[model samples]
Target: MADRLQGKVAVVTGAGNGIGEGCARLFAAEGAHVIGIDRAGADECCDLLDEGATGALFQRIGDRHGRIDILVNAAAFAVFDWTETLSYADWKATLSGELDIVFLATRAAWPWLKASGSASIINFASANARHALEGSPALAHCAGKGGVMAMTRQLAMEGAPHNIRANSIAPGFIKTQATARHLAADPAFAAQVLRKNMLQRLGEPDDIGWCAVWLASDEARYVTGADIPVDAGATAW
Candidate 1:
């Protein structure tokens, strides 16, 4: 439990806040030297959507660290809209934010990960990737996360040859700053979420962060190409 990831070098995107921050803090506590990346509110601020900047940033990190034992792609942005009213531009932007960012970061970190000979890549999917939340207008989010799910399997397959493990975590309605706005707009949303959740409560960032910790550690050496749901059983039904 303690020091599960001792001496590992971890790069966590979107570590400025929310689940990414939770994971970064936990990884460090477990003795990993964590590099938190975000446009703001992280150890290394960079707009991951910028291809050149992202690549350069990863190169710097890889050079400084020698190897990257774990890569957590948790940064994302989405403009939620009903499918009927969704625009092409918004869709593309969502894919770019959610799906493309993952690819860019992974692509940039590939060399360093391979150098480690036993690296782990943890991606963030969502319950939306599997099922729709009744009140949530997240068409683009669903598509993006679905892409992440498929891409994770592909990454696992490709990474297998290099002893690198790839997997994803599909989280439910965790209470984060991002979700706070929705909660404010619809006073009944929280109650509805609880009704659907078997655990009968909103999840915290730590709920998903713990799962990321295990996946990043050697304890999950055999768990590649899997999508673990940290949804408080909301999707179980």
Candidate 2:
């Protein structure tokens, strides 16, 4: 059987590891020509936050692939601290980096997405944006993701006439390299996080990848401007 994304060209940010890596790999497996970008040193890593980098990637994609069918914004960073204690630099790194990367990538890929007639842009958000996490200095992340949610909706509205769709995924407590770092620091905290989930287990990278696949494929052609939570029902309770 033919693959679902056989002729699609996808750009996935933060594709060096974790959920981003999962999305890139799965998209590739589904027959899409994947361009994985990240800051980390890996096969597909590109520092998307750096000025001009994201645009350059999109330019390269256009020049080489001729079109982009999917753009997944999954690059993010966080500095944990109370609102009063968080530094300006940390906040900027968390919020500005995400916004800059997403904006630049979207703008760069706008024409191709419009041309594709069924293109999709997937932005990554966090469940922390919906519920407060005790003792976690996530104000910047929450604010940034909230902005992503808004941007997703706005883009959906603007792109609808052109057949481009934008949607966001808010993941909770996924077992990614980043989350593993936190889990290593406090096993008890990890346990607490798992317990809060309706499934009573941590999520895998593939969980989010599958959702991205659905959103990017024709299966979800009607879905746009929605924030879908792949949080094991963590938001339910």
Candidate 3:
């Protein structure tokens, strides 16, 4: 299991904390040279929202690494708001954060990924994308994650001929700063989440990171256009 990605170069967004940080650590542990990207405070600081900056960032990575082997689009801007209360500006911003970043980053990395001779792209979706959680105001969250899946599918199709694979991971209620807010704000939220998850316990950041490791590894060479749910069976029911 060790050195599963030896000598490979991986670009991980949102690597400052949470699941992205987990992936960056795990991937490096498995022997890949990882470039952690966040808006600020990471191995590199580049606003991926800016197409020009994104392209330049990847170009620099490509030049340094010689090729890019993996990409994890784990950065997303999500907010909790009911559909009625979700403002037009917020909705647009949500979509831009969740979907546009993925599009821009992947597009910018295309040449280097192709240069890898074979590449893997892991996009972070969410359990909320396909299932509605009771008492959780995530109307825009659902739309954003859903759009991520759709975009991933198209990326897989486009990348197939180039021996590039694209897939997504929909994670369950993992204990992170974001989820901590929900737990602190509403006790019932934790109860409902745990009740839905068959595991009867919350997931850790490493849970998604480990899944991401496998997806990035050569073992999953055939797993393109797939959406793997890292939920604790929360969506099964």
* TM-score of candidate 1 to 2 decimals: 0.99
Write the candidate numbers in order of decreasing lDDT.
1, 3, 2
Which should have the higher lDDT, number 1 or number 2? 1
On TM-score, the candidate that comes out on top is: 1
Residue range with the least summed lDDT across 10 consecutive positions in model 1: 192-201
Which digits, one per residue and each the tens of the lDDT, describe model 2 over residues 109-144? 898888787899999878987897665668888888
- RMSD (Cα, Å) for all candidates, in order, is 0.7, 1.6, 0.9
Q: Give the 10-residue window scoring lowest on summed lDDT in candidate 2.
A: 41-50
- For 1-237, candidate 3 gives per-residue lDDT tens digits of 689998889999999988999999999999999999998768999898999999999989999888899999998897679888889999999999999999999999999999998899999889989989988888888999999999999999999999999999999999987679889988888888988999999999999999999999999998999999999999998
Candidate 1 deviant stretches above 4 angstroms: none
Q: How many pairs of residues in model 2 come into backbone collision? A: 1
Worst 10 residues of 3 by lDDT: 176-185
Those runs of model 3 whose alpha carbons end farther than 4 Å from true positions after fitting are none
Instruction: Evaluate all candidate structures by whole-model CA lDDT and list the values in order.
Output: 0.95, 0.84, 0.92
In order of listing, the candidates' clash counts read 0, 1, 0
Give me the candidate number with maximum lDDT. Answer: 1
